[model samples]
Target: MPFKTYLINKTNNRKFRLDGVLRSRRLPAKHKLCQKFRQHMVLRTDQLPPKVDLRPDMTPIEDQSQIGSCTANCLAGAYEYLTKKSNGMNMDVSRLFIYYNARIKGNY
Candidate 1:
């Protein structure tokens, strides 16, 4: 895992550390994901459902041990969800396939 660490400027004789995704990185800004979705009418706060549960749609958990393939695993879960939603079939997807392809494209 690649992490960039930074020290805060407003420190009073104490060290403050911050570590997270690098915002300036290309991947984070390269795509505007929101634009891909169809625009829907904005719902008023009162019109929204009181409770929403998507857990029912989610399949069984997948253990990823420690191979640093979080992205691939996430994509696989999403793919499984789409598959089930499209054809109502619970399928096990190959995380390695997605991982290898992403790694090749990303050059990680």
Candidate 2:
């Protein structure tokens, strides 16, 4: 018998984390157990209703510019703002600027 890690995805958007002795090819066993658990939960939901709540606002997502380097395009602008507000450092390095430099140098 070989040791294995079984990642069981359940219907209720939950997972079954089982790490112990299981029979060889016990996938059917795990799936049946998860189904039984879901059935039990559905029976309990009759007594309790779920609540719908909205999450709090953190900040707005910045627009993405097509300058090749999406990684720097996203963070470089945000980091400029953060550094300017917190540490009083004015650093403006955009993906468009980098792309322009790369083009001028005939490297890309």
Candidate 3:
């Protein structure tokens, strides 16, 4: 079957209207990075230093095994960094929780 038909059937099983949900959501405007790049006539390669490590202070590298949870893992890492910077607390957000939530929301 076609992708659209598959999506329609899946949404129907969940008693959800994909069209209505999509229509209700507002599309995001152009990203700030895109806007900044658009205004420049030529790319500025010299502005940034040769070796810049912008890694957060307390954020540690994470490894997500065989499962398809890279996005969730990255989000958890970012959350950990933000929380640590905002307050001096080193809290570990569960990647599994994020992954499960995203999966349930039909985003995975």
lDDT top scorer:
1
What is model 2's C-alpha RMSD? Answer: 14.8
The number of clashing residue pairs in model 1 is 0
- Each prediction's Cα lDDT score? 0.80, 0.56, 0.72
How many Å off is the CA of 38 in candidate 3?
22
| lDDT (tens digit, per residue) of candidate 1 on 1-108 | 557566756756555557665444334454665334455677799999999987767788988888888988999999998888778898999999999999899897
lDDT score, candidate 1: 0.80
Off by over 4 Å in 1: 1-41
Better-scoring candidate (lDDT), 2 or 3: 3
Task: List clashing residue pairs in candidate 1.
Answer: none
Compute the lDDT of residue 52 as modeled in candidate 2. 39
lDDT of 3 by residue, 1-108 (tens): 222322335645654333432332444575653433345376478975688565655677777889879999989988898788879788879999999999999964
User: Sorted by lDDT, highest first, which candidate order results?
Assistant: 1, 3, 2
Residue 72 lDDT, candidate 2, scale 0-100: 53
Candidate 2 local lDDT, 1-108, one digit each (tens): 446556666666565656656545444555646443343344476576587332221123445655456655566666666666666656666666755665778765
TM-score of 1: 0.55
